[model samples]
Target: MACLVIHGGAGTIPRASLTPEGHQAARDGLRDALRAGWAVLGQGGLALDAVQAAVVALENHPSFNAGHGAVLNAAGEHELDAAIMDGRDRRAGAVASARYIRNPVLAARRVMEASDCVLVSATGADEFAREQGLDMVEQSYFTTPLRQQHWQRAHEEKAGLLKRERTEAEKHGTVGAVALDDLGNLAAATSTGGYTYKRVGRVGDAPVIGAGTYAANDVVAVSCTGLGELFIRRGTAQDIAARILYRGDDLSSAAAAAIADLTADGAGAGLIAVDAAGAMAMPHNTEGMYRGSVTADGVLSVGIYSDDFAAVETIG
Candidate 1:
């Protein structure tokens, strides 16, 4: 059995706000990620490798907030964060507030493989990436023309609105991947640039293995996207796994329940889960969340809007 899942992000994004081209771009990105994972799984690769490949595809895409086109910080620099987990070994690695590292998730994987530590931060992670000879770039290299325009528009919107503390909820987009490989193992990964105008050194759920990323051979693997603060507060990723392991909930029910709990608490988010059986689920409380999956039966499905959920019956 080989299954893979991906998410663009989860939030209150109105369908009307996305142009047809924007929607197509997101769908294309998801398809690319899914195909990347499928290619690995097709060759009998481990779940961790499949997930890493999938997320790397998203990280390289300009449309998503992960690697190249990530959101800028308060100082107008891109700070990347990512995490990866291998359930079979119960080992994980993460990097937060990192700059200049071209692929944060690969850096995190190196940390997991080379060090005894579970997490590393900013300069330290960048140093590790340098040591490993990963591509390093100036902060300016991360700034995309569309992102710059979005930042300018955000500034204008901020100036007009009376609300001074409007959070990153206003700029909602994240990319994540989860996979169940042929050997019946599960792995998960998540990457993000954090929210727009994020405070310096602000660590979101993306870098926390069990919060933003989790994998368990006994149950499922999960990757989350949404309000980072709320996910940190609720431990969304682990909670979903707990529900599946403790309450005997199916993967889809557990994921849906987790999203429902967040929404009930006024925290918007979305999640992707893949069980050991290659069952998958993606649920969100917003108008749209970019998601796609391949089932154990080799069926492929992808969608961008909330309404697409009804057509993907296997998920829920």
Candidate 2:
């Protein structure tokens, strides 16, 4: 009953803003991510490895905001954040404000496995990644033309050169994955290029262990994407696990309750979770979230809009 779930991001993605080509691109990206993780789980890999693989695929995909297509900060620079947790013993690692690491998630995994620290930040994190021999890239590697335009528009709006406000879609984005492996071990990973035009050094919940990522064997593994501040204040990921642990809530109920609380506060976000039994849940308060899932038998499902979910034939 091993299973994996992933989310590209969650927000009020206006249908009119999305062209058909863009919609297909996002779905294809989700499918690639699912297959990347499924390949590991299907071959008896660790849950941690599976999740990291999945998120790496997302980070490489240009459609999402994690690695290559990360948005610029107020300083017009990229400051990426990522985290990974293993439910086997709750060991975790995170990196914040990383400027040069190509895959922040891989750096996070190194922090968890090779270093004594659970979190590293700024230049120190970049240096640590270098020392660990992880792939490194110039800051420009993260910038895309679209992101540059978005940044420019943000500045223009702030300077009153543009009258229209940026849509909710431009505000935030993240990539995350959670999995229950054949061994019953669970794991979660999240990565993001914080919100567009965020202040320099503004770290989001994507790298915060309990807020955006959490995993506990025999319980639940969770990864969240949305308004970082709200997720941080709510301890969103841990809250779901707590609900299931203390209140006897099921995976779906607990995850729904957590999102419901956020919705009540007018937050636009979502999350993906998986239990030790291989049960999976994806719930969001926004109009749409790029999400997908795969089972041990190789069946795949992907969705964007609320009613757009489709299950495909077993993946090879």
Candidate 3:
């Protein structure tokens, strides 16, 4: 079995303060998560389980943005969104505008397994999670003093500055994992805390399967993170797969072209993809994106910045 995994970019990365040890720690975490999924697929686990295991490992990491270190909403609470898709059956499930669910990806999978629906909102998704006996914490459990302080600082910085870019350098809010397993199965999953100081119900591409994540056995599995508006407008994830399947582009070319197109249209985002042949690509238009992947040969590669600049390369 061959496996590949990528992240949008690790969040809260202190560029100036990052020690060599800190950088290695982040790389090791990503490598370990990829290995977790690779081990599952090596043992003949389903692609869906592989993706879930990798994402669960990331979600549990307080250093990342998906679960523990998630951003705060305008209400000063942490609302989450997530989705998962199984390409074998084209079955997908998603939750948007949710709060208190620990692993939103699992909730999305439950929705796919248990319902005839494709999308579920916060309250309804919470109901389904409750019915399934998943852990449910109170809203307060979602907040951290650090995140709250950051939200407060963002609000203070943005006060009365309407024309300023809405994003802070340190506040990327999404994380994801995608995989192509040995059985020729493909799966993708994405989760997010949304933008810092986002509105109570603001839903980004994270929970929308085709927008934030998509997979198909015929092509590849894709997961995206970054500016949501551009993803929704361009349908980035599905478009990448479409170009590969319909237009005959390879995985690397399709991913690079898709991200380049998004960047040309003024969207700052990044993507990770893996094809049936185990080819992988992770690209971003931003100054940096925390991404890494493991090839079929057990060689792990991790990178933080664009390849065009030699000074920014941190790991491989």
Candidate 4:
């Protein structure tokens, strides 16, 4: 069986806060990403390649917070981070605080296939991607008026000129994918632009191997989105796999347990996981999570609100 799951992010997404256009855009983006990965899997591609392809689609969509529409830091600059992993060998590669790379996930894949190191950061990561001839873009390429407004509001809030709550988009967001290929291999990938108005060089769970992304043959593949610091401290991604392997919990139960822990601490979080048996679990502690999935039967679904999950259609 082959399955693919992906998440745009998780946070306090009040239904009243989203416009009709915004909602439609999100669903469209999720569908595109799901199809992108499913296409690879349908053709019998590697799980690693499927996950990478899905994440690359999300990274390219402006509606999500990975590549093109990444959030800007307090310094008003775009800093990206991404990670990719192969479950069979536990091989992983990551880059953090990269400024110019067009798709950090692609760079992470390059690092995994081409380098001896598991992680790279900042200027070095940027330069390395350039040396590899990956697509490079100007910093301005990532900036969008929507993100600029979010940063402006946060900046005002920080200056004590305004008192307000952060919407889901401003609170935080990430894009990720996890998949099981026809060959029974599992893989996971994650990418993010961090939170609104964060410090310029801050690195989140997205670029961390075990924190935000993890995969293992016959076990599970996991990719997470949430408050990065909380996800890191809890080791959330790997925790689900441990609960299943060490504690004898089923995939759904293990995912629920990990989400319960984060919920207890008021950390809005969510994750998508697929076990080797083709079972899938998407558990979240937030009001809503932008997520989608494709089952082994090729039934594709997309959801945002907590109650919105129903098969939207079947994908070939």
Candidate 5:
């Protein structure tokens, strides 16, 4: 069986805050990502390729908080994070706080195959990207009118210039994909621009293998988003797999428990996961999660808000 699931982010997406146009935009973005991953799986490609291809679609989409449309940091710059994992060998690659790379996930894959290390950061990651001939663009390339507005609003909020409070959607966003291939291999990939107005060098769960991304042939492939601090502390992604592998929990129980664990700790997070048995779970302790999924049946479903999501979107 070949299946893939993906998420744009998880948070309180209030219907009031999302206009019909915005809702449609989010659904369209998810559909685009689904088609991209499905194309790979339809070609009998590996899960690794499917996951990467899916993530790239989100990264390129302006609606998602990744790659080209990433949010800004305190310094008004974009520092992207990404990670990818392969189940067959349990190999992982990641990049943190890199500025120049167009696609941090691609750079991460390069590190996984071309280097001896599993992680890279800062100046070194930039050097690696350049050496690998990864696309380089001026930092402004990541700035969009929408993100610039966010950065300005955050600055105003920090300075007590804006009287309004922040919305849940403004608090978090991330893009990730997980896949199980026809060959029974699993893989996961996650990419993010971190939260709005974060510290310049702040690195979140996206680039942390077990926290935001994990894959294993005997357990599951997982990608998580939200509350990076809590995810890192709890090893969120891996914990879901652990419950399945060690505690005999099914995909549903394990995924729900992982999100429950985070919420009990007074934090919010969400994840999309697929087990070795081809069962999939997308769990979140939030108001809404922008997500989608596809299975061997060739049907695709994408949803934005909780009340509007179809069960078919979660299952197939």
Candidate 6:
């Protein structure tokens, strides 16, 4: 049995702020990711490869916050972060504060395939990506008028120069995927551009192993988004898997509990998970999370808000 689940960050996404076309676009992005992973699984690929492909698709989409459409940092630069894990043996790879590399998730997978290191950061990460012959794009490639406007607005707001506050959707965005392959192995991946106008060289949970990304064949695979610091402080991903492995909790229970822990600490966050048995869970403390799942039984669902969950069903 094989299943795939994905998330495109979480935050306050009021229905009023989303046009029907915009909402459908995000849903289509999720469906594209699901189909991308499903194609790999259909061909008997490893869970790691399936998830990598799925996340790479998200990274390439200009509608999301990773890769080509990443938001600018406080310095008006793009510094990306990404992580991936294989449950079969708990192998993990990550990159942070990276620039020039077009797809950070692909670079992360290369780190797992070639390097002894689990995490690499800053210019060093960029250098490593080059040495590995990964695709590189001009820094301008990541810049969009929307991101530039966001950075300027953030700077102004922080200085009390703007009367209107930014919407919650502008505050955070990330892309992640989790998968179970026919071989009974699981994997998870996450990628992000960090918060709008974040400090350059700032690392986040997206690249922190066991925090935003974790997988175990015996328990669960997890990928998280939202506030990076809180997710790291609570080791969000691993804690969920730990609950399932040690505390004898089921998939949904452990996932909801983990998000609740983050909420209890006054943090906003969300995560997507899949257990060894192919049961999937996606939970968030925010009003909305861009998420989707395709279970082993062919139950395919996607939603931008909790209210949309009950309305979606299997593609079959």
Best by lDDT: 2
TM-score quality measure for candidate 5? 0.96
Off by over 4 Å in 1: 161-170, 309-316
Clashing pairs in 1: none
Candidate 6's TM-score reads: 0.95
What are the per-residue Cα lDDT tens digits for candidate 1 across 129-220? 89888888888767788677656656766678534433333475688899988888889999999887778889899998788889989788
Q: Please tell me which model should have the higher lDDT, number 1 or number 2.
A: 2
- Candidate 5: C-alpha lDDT: 0.88
Worst 10 residues of 2 by lDDT: 163-172
Model 3 lowest lDDT segment of ten: 307-316
Give candidate 1's total backbone clashes: 0
Every candidate's CA RMSD: 3.2, 1.2, 3.6, 1.0, 2.0, 1.7
Ranking by lDDT: 2, 4, 5, 6, 1, 3
Residue-level lDDT of model 2, residues 284-306, one tens digit each, is: 88888989999878899999988
lDDT per model, in order? 0.82, 0.92, 0.76, 0.91, 0.88, 0.87
Clashing residue pair totals per candidate (backbone < 3 A): 0, 0, 1, 0, 0, 0
Per-residue lDDT tens digits for candidate 6, residues 1-316, read 8889999888535788778877888888888888888778877889998899889988887667899778888888899999999998999999999988999999899888899999988888888999999999988998877678778889998899998888656776899999998889999999999989897778889999999999999789999988899889888898988898888999999999998888898877889999988888888888898898887766778888877864254543
Query: Per-residue CA lDDT of candidate 3, range 77-159, in tens?
Result: 88888999998987899988878788888889999999888889978888888898888877766666656766876777668
Instruction: Tell me the lDDT of model 6 at 302.
Output: 84
Is candidate 2 or 3 superior in lDDT?
Answer: 2
Q: What TM-score against the true fold does each predicted structure earn?
A: 0.92, 0.97, 0.90, 0.98, 0.96, 0.95
lDDT of 5 by residue, 260-296 (tens): 8899998767899999888989888778888999977
Local error of candidate 4 at residue 127 (angstroms): 0.7
